[model samples]
Structure formats: C-alpha cells, structure tokens
Target: MTLKIPLENSSFNLDVSGIAGFFGGEESFAAMSSVHLVRGRRWLGWYNSPGSYYVAKKYGVLAKSRVWDGLYPGVNVDPTTMLELDGKVGPRYVAAHSGTRMEKTGHLAYLLASHYSDLEVDQVIPGPSAKSEAHITIASLEEFKEFEGYPKLPADHLSPFDPIATVPIAFSVGASVMCAIFGDWYCFAMIILGVVCNGVSCFVIGSGVLKIKQPNPSPHSPPGDGVLFNAPGSRVILLKGSEKIISSITRGRFFLEYKSQSQYHDIGYSSVALTMQFLLQLFIVPQGQLFGQIMFLSSLGVSWIFNAYLASVDREDLQKRILMRVLLQKPTFRTVALPKWTSLVVFAAVYLQAKPEGTRGLLEQLIPNDTAVWRLVKSAVVEAVERNKDPSEVVAERNLDHLDNQERGLLEDMMKQASIGYNAGNDFKL
Candidate 1:
C-alpha cells in the first residue's frame, strides 16, 4: 500500500500557495517511498521526486526541493551540513550561494536557521561546499520557523523507510540525539552505523539518478562546463543537459561530506570508532541495557560533533569569530534576524526536552558529587550579571570568590567571561 502524507502546516501558507499555483496536476506518490512525498501536487518547482523533497525537509531545508534540482550523484550535501551566513535577511543578515545572492532556498534556509537552531550563531551555511563565501544568516531557528511564510510541519517532520541507504544515517542521527539525552552508548553506536549507512544511501540515490541517461543527446542544448557531462576522459567541466547528472554529483558530495563530518565529529578516530561502537553494542552480552547506552553515547557524540562541526562551518560561531568579537567588545550572539541567543538556548533546551532520558542522565554529570549549594552559588554569581552589576561587582556581591576554593572553581573563569555580558544581552548581535 502507498503511504499518505498529511498537510498540517499553515505556517508556510505563502510557500504552499506558490507551490499550489504550479500544482495544476495532482501527483500520486504511490511509488514514492519517502513519507514527506506521499501525496502532493506535482509541479516543476521543488524536487521532481517526492523522496528528495522529504529528505531535504528532514535535513532542515524547507525550500530544498527547489534549491536542489534533484537527487544527483557525486554531490556531497546533507541537512547537518550548515549554511554560514555573512550578512542579513532583510535589515539583518545578507545571504550568498555559489557567489550569487541566494534567491533559491534562501528564505527556507533563513527560516531554518532562524528556527530550531543552536550555538552563538552568526551565519547559516549551505552544505558540502568548502568554499568560504557560500553562506548566509537569516535568523535564529525559533524566529525563522515562525517567519511570515514558513510552512507548517506534518507531525514534527518525518521520512519514510526506503532507499535503505539514507534510513540508517538519518536514523543514526535521530537516534544519536536520543542517546545524548539518555546516555545510551548502544544507541549511539547505532547512530554511527546509521550515519555511515546514510552515506551509502546517498550513493545509491545518486547512482540511481545517475543512470537516467537519455537515449540520444539533443544536439541543440550544448552542455555547459561543469561536472555534469564529462565524457569519461574529457577535461572540460562540461555542464550538459545533465541537470540530473549535476544533481547526482551534488548529492554524492553532500552525503560524502555529511559522512566526513560524522567522522570529523568523531575527530578522525572517525568511522573507525563507529565501527567499534557497532561491534561493542552488537557483540557485548547484556544485550539490552549496555546496548542502549552504547547507542546513546554514539548518538550524543555524533550530535555534539555535528554542533561543533557546524561551529566550524559557521565559523562566525567558531573560536575565531567568538574570540574576535569578544576581543573587540562584548559578544552578543546573533541569530540571523531574530533576538540573538534565543535560538541557541531554545535549541539546547528543546533537545533536552526531546531526550528527557538523556537529559536526566546528563544531570548526574552536571551535579558535583561532593557539593550542591556551592554550584548553586556559582549559578547565583552567573545570574548576578543580569542584576546589572559589573562582572567584578557581581562576583563580589555574591562573594563568588569563595567559589575559588570550591570544587566548581574552574567554572569561575568561564562565568567571569560570560558575565561580561550579564547585562549586555540586549546590545549584542552577530
């Protein structure tokens, strides 16, 4: 039986309307495997395939259907692959892609970045390309999703099981997130394997699309120079009628990089650790309990790695940007267009909410085994800045120096720095 996707989103009413305009023809995704593509109007816009559109949305790209031509081979992009923003959306951040002002998916990217995001975000970067200029900032994830034309989500955004390749990786990421919150190493391991499996999925998807060769080349539309139509030994980056070809290559690169980032998050111990985690979870005895921990740890590690890697891709959030901005003055984390820090806090908080098991597990680590009230004092010191006192003044008033000798002492320096903006939240922007 074919799957049916429901429409619950009125959020992107404008975008849906735009889509409806071209949806003169109803298309049945009876053959389409991805749930996001179940049954929707077919149009020239978005992706030609329902699966592609579904995957794009899952990866946090709302307008990804339109931005990417189709699932092409050799392209390395993923949802985790971040888009680094340079300027502003309207009066805020400017956007660019492939050296051009982002017209496609710009709004979608902007909206995603603005909503459901984390970090002291500065910019949003599109995936796979290492090119520095290919990024833009829209707003924090929270505000972006609520933007004027954002689309409504269907039951928190899900993809159907098919094309086995992507399923594992996507599941890995999703599961890893659960692991982090639940401290399940086995689940985490599953996440690692799943991510690699996703790379394989990308390959399958790319290859499948790549095979759609035309019987006879149209002599009229001479192919442009790109990776699309390389006649095996040809040197010219021949761009051809292979919109599908370019898309395949694009798809390959995307998954490749996404896999690479997974490894990168693994810090070059890489997929090797993933293999190890999978082995441990699979072979180790107690089966259920430890296996779950393995999964959680694996997932947590990967998820954190994604965040840290994104911090690199979105270098504005990297140490360089954070430090430079901190050096010049106080740092006010910018969330594309909306209130800064809102996204970062919300992202972390939401993740915490989603994985209550993991969040509770992490609480044990956060709590000092020895002292409780002192950690409380440090918190008080951190909050003091909000009281509008200077960092020094706040520390002194709270007698936080007493914390110097306390067990949580090391946190003092971190608090001191963060406290600089204790009173500056309203003033800072990325």
Candidate 2:
C-alpha cells in the first residue's frame, strides 16, 4: 500500500535514459496514475496481475480472436535510460510497460526479458529491499532492428500505448504516435455484458414478474420442479428433467424454451439496442473521456438488478418453502381433520433439523430477525463453550473476587442459563 509517486520528501528519484514507442494505452487501465512529478499524491502502481488470466481466459481478453496487450494503463514506462551531456541529452528508445508479476522479482521485469533480450544490463536500479517501493533505472539499451526482421505488431516493443491515456509522450524520450488494436472492449461490449449479467440475475428473482401463465397447458397440467435455462432463446438446461426431482427423467417437470416468431422479435430488438448503445459508447469514449468515465460508472447501477432469483433459493425463507415442498410431496394427511398443536411442532421440527449446507443462501432472505441462522450459530458457539467447561469453572472460581463485575456477571449468568438450556443437568446416577 506504500504508493510511491510524486509525494513530498520521496527518498529516491527513478530516471530512465532509453525509451520509445506508444504511450496512450498506458492511461486506459489505470486512469489517474501517471509519471508526472506532483508533490504529495498517493499513486496506485501495478502490483502483480498477469496478462495470461486477463488476456487468455475465454471470457476476458481471448473473447476476441486477436488482442493487443499494449493497451496500457497510465504511465508509459520507458524501458531504457538516458544521459544528459549535450543539447541532445535524453532517454534512448524502449518498449511499453507490460503488467507486473514476472518469473522471479515481482515488478514488470518480464517484458524486458521476453521482448528485449538484446539489451545488456549497464546498471539496474532495483526497488526498495526491505520496503515495498521499487525504482528501476536502465542505463542504455542496444536495439537490434533486424533482430528478426519486423514484428507482427508494428508499434514499438519498448513502450506500449495506453487506452484513455492515448496521447503520445513529449519529445524527451522520442516516443512515437500510438498504434493500438481496438477490438470489442471499446465501450459498447462491456455495457452489453454488464446489462446481461445484471438483467438475467434480476429476471430470475423478481416476484410477480415471472407469473406469466404457461402458454401450453392441459386442463390438469403436471406440476413442474426445478429451474429452466435457455441460451440465446434455445433451451440449454431444463431442471424439470433433473434426476433429483424425478427418479426417472421421464417424470421431470416439463418446460420448453423454444422461441416463437413473436418472442424472436423482442429478443432481436433488445439485442440490437444493446449493440447499438455499446457502439455509441465506443465511438464517444475516445473523444469524451469524462463521458466514457460516466458511462462506465452508470453501468454499475444495474449490476445487481437481474440476480434476484439466485437469492430466492439462497434465502432463509426458502427453508420454510423447502419444508413445505418436501412434506407436501407425500400426499397423505389421510382422514385426520383436526390437529392444531401437532402442526406447530411439525413446522418447528424443520427449523431444528434442517442441515446448513443443504440450504445455501439462508442468509440472503434473512433480515436479522429471530431467524434460524443466528439461533443456530449462537447455539453451536454456546454448546462448544459448555463442552469446554472453562467458563463455568472460571466464573465459579472467581465469583468471590469480582462477582459484581459486568463481564464476570455475564459469564456467570451464561453458565446458569446454559446449564438447563441444553438439558445437560446431571440426574440419573446409573
């Protein structure tokens, strides 16, 4: 957390002599962080995130066929160092700063090893040893142009470009204009993904909204059990056919996810709207950075909008519903018309006996009431303390010393209260 940037009384000064290539991509990943000399500012430096996870994962960078890792955050880190002797005294050309987490030492040293192996180490200014901060300074880099002809990527290998920080660096390092590979992450794609994650989660949980009657139903339609999932309007996972619900798949709750001509129109419209809006954002962001920032901010509003149904199963109220679901499955209350007290006990048994893992989101629907969760957790802790026997012995041993103290009194009260509460009172001598 020691953000070493342009802060007041910073101990060391990190200077690079050689650096080249793009700078804009550096600004995009981290918007505010830059190499500018501002006194007293907490800077967020890239710690240890790999390009493999963010770039190689199917949903992340590899979502697009080809991706440019050059889309830098802020700070177009010059890989090379400079010397000030004459009028043309400045840094030599270098590549963009790849992310942190290299093979050995933590900072972004891997980029130099992977791409620019030709540059011999003149002098390296490593970061703080005992402390977290680091500052690397390269003396000079000897570039090999025909090291292997031209690179598949045309931009400078030494300096990568930032997204929003797309501006080229000043004349000091002789940095060139940025050339980035702009694919899907522009603006619209993210908006659509955000809306989808939020929207779907909400649609499943929102009450009353899911009450649209089944379109095709017989006079006495069989009851359905489990959830329904469809991908791109095509049925994917049908919980109605779950083996858990039915001993045989034939008895699964029957539901269909096929979209008719009517449903397709709405789906298409929504899809088009999402794509269009995303494109408009991509188009606008490169021009209006603040507007792009606003768009990204606004999307978070609906992030949780669609995940309501996920909560329902996870909710504590579902435990009650589950009991009703389980008990009602046994169609037998056969000829008994009266039993008021028995019903209450039957209801209470579900609360006392239900397993915690069997009911996962018990915390979701709970509202800090006299819910089962608190009672269960509290009871387990008390039971452990009782089994340990230290509380009672400690309280009894010290009763004469400070019986009136609040903490001691509480411990004493708890021992008295728990003795009979768990039916641990010794009785049978046998």
Candidate 1: count of backbone clashes, pairs at least 3 residues apart or interchain: 83
Model 2: per-residue Cα lDDT over 1-430, one tens digit each: 5433122244432211011001111222121111111111112111111111111111121111122122212222111110000011111111111111111211111221122223232322222132311111111211112222221111222122222211111210111111111221333343444334323311211110100011232334332222111111111111121122221111111111213221222322332333343345434434322332333333321211211211122222322232222312322111111112111111111222223321122111111234333343334323333344322343344324523366455444444433322222122011
Poorest stretch of ten by lDDT in candidate 1: 91-100
Query: Candidate 1: global Cα-lDDT?
Result: 0.28
TM-score of 1: 0.22
Q: Rate the local accuracy (lDDT) of all candidates.
A: 0.28, 0.22
lDDT tens digits by residue: candidate 1, 193-293: 53453343333222211011112323342221121111211111111123222221122121112233321322222223323433443453132244344
- Give the best candidate by TM-score: 1
Which model scores highest in lDDT?
1
Count of backbone collisions in candidate 2: 43
Candidate 2 — which residues are off by over 4 angstroms? 1-250, 254-263, 289-295, 301-430
Instruction: Score candidate 2 by TM-score against the native.
Output: 0.20
Compute the lDDT of residue 314 as modeled in candidate 1: 29
Score candidate 2 by lDDT: 0.22
